[model samples]
Target: MNKLTLFIIALLLSPVAVAATPIEQRMADYNPDGNLTFDAKRGEALWHQQRMVDGKQRDCNTCHGKDLTQAGKHVKTGKVIEPMAYSANKERFTKLKKVKKWFKRNCKWTYGRECTTQEKGDLLKYLSQY
Candidate 1:
């Protein structure tokens, strides 16, 4: 093969070339909001916090499990949810669209509203740590 073709092949085969890290991609979502910063501490707190949902307490941990590295089950459907930690599941937040979609769906389910960009950034920062 020619040098140019070989280079292209190598680029295609390299995992790093495939996409940005979950944290990096998540950060891009936060960048447009001037002066916003993501805090893993806040994310962790959010992860465990309970909110009133239909007159009952609900939180991300209710469905995601206390351990971010471990797989969790859907509280109502019994369906398996992949681990949220970037370390445990490299696919977690790599796609911008998928991340946005889940944040929209999950935030509403857990908090009965859309998460602010700050909340999304914080949660992603927290989850990416493990």
Candidate 2:
């Protein structure tokens, strides 16, 4: 076999590795004994922070309202959404996958960029505390 052929075989058999920062490695880390409670304060602050989007500045509260406790309805469809009260929506949040999806969407909407895992974790922690 030629050297190129051996190289190709090695590449196929080698493990795929991606580098991640320590914070990223630990962002998903949770303390089993530590409290996973919510802290609405941080979520509230993140929700209102203005960031650049499409070269324009915006924030989540621009559409979602500063106080998330009130029920919001789809302006056109009139579909209502519950307040982001943690206890009221505990079941929906038991799965981390669901939480990540929303974080990606909401982060882009509010910050115009995907939030770091730490930011997502912190936001989720704060929300859970509520």
Candidate 3:
């Protein structure tokens, strides 16, 4: 093989190329052990948990819907959200920017506060499973 071809192959096979995903990078703070230790069950529960917001109940399911594989509509804007599950959607948690953006926006909207590192980690863990 040519030098350039070999270099490209080596780069592709390097540890950096096979390193943790964007979600994993975000979860690193909560998962210091470098392992996926977050509880998916807890994440699932948190998604369904209803919180009283301004005398109204709100949750991730409020817009994302109960089924992760199906598209959901925004309660207020009526905007359609793409399916979150990797099974149903080819792209999910593939971009760090989008992931951070949505978590920040959605967490504040649902819980009235910024989510903790653990909360974000758990949520990503739960969503990635599907």
Task: Identify the candidate with maximal TM-score.
Answer: 1
TM-score of each: 0.78, 0.53, 0.75
Off by over 4 Å in 1: 1-20
- Candidate 2 differs from the real structure by a C-alpha RMSD in angstroms, to one decimal, of 13.8
lDDT of 3 by residue, 29-86 (tens): 4577766567778888888878897788999988988898999999899999998775
| TM-score, model 1 to reference | 0.78
Candidate 1 per-residue lDDT, tens place, 15-53, comes to 766576767777767777558888899988887778886
CA lDDT, every model vs. true structure: 0.84, 0.58, 0.80
Off by over 4 Å in 3: 1-36
At residue 2, give the lDDT of candidate 2: 100
**Best-fitting candidate, scored by lDDT:** 1
Root-mean-square deviation of Cα positions for candidate 3 versus the true structure, in angstroms: 4.6
**Weakest 10 consecutive residues of candidate 1 by summed lDDT:** 16-25
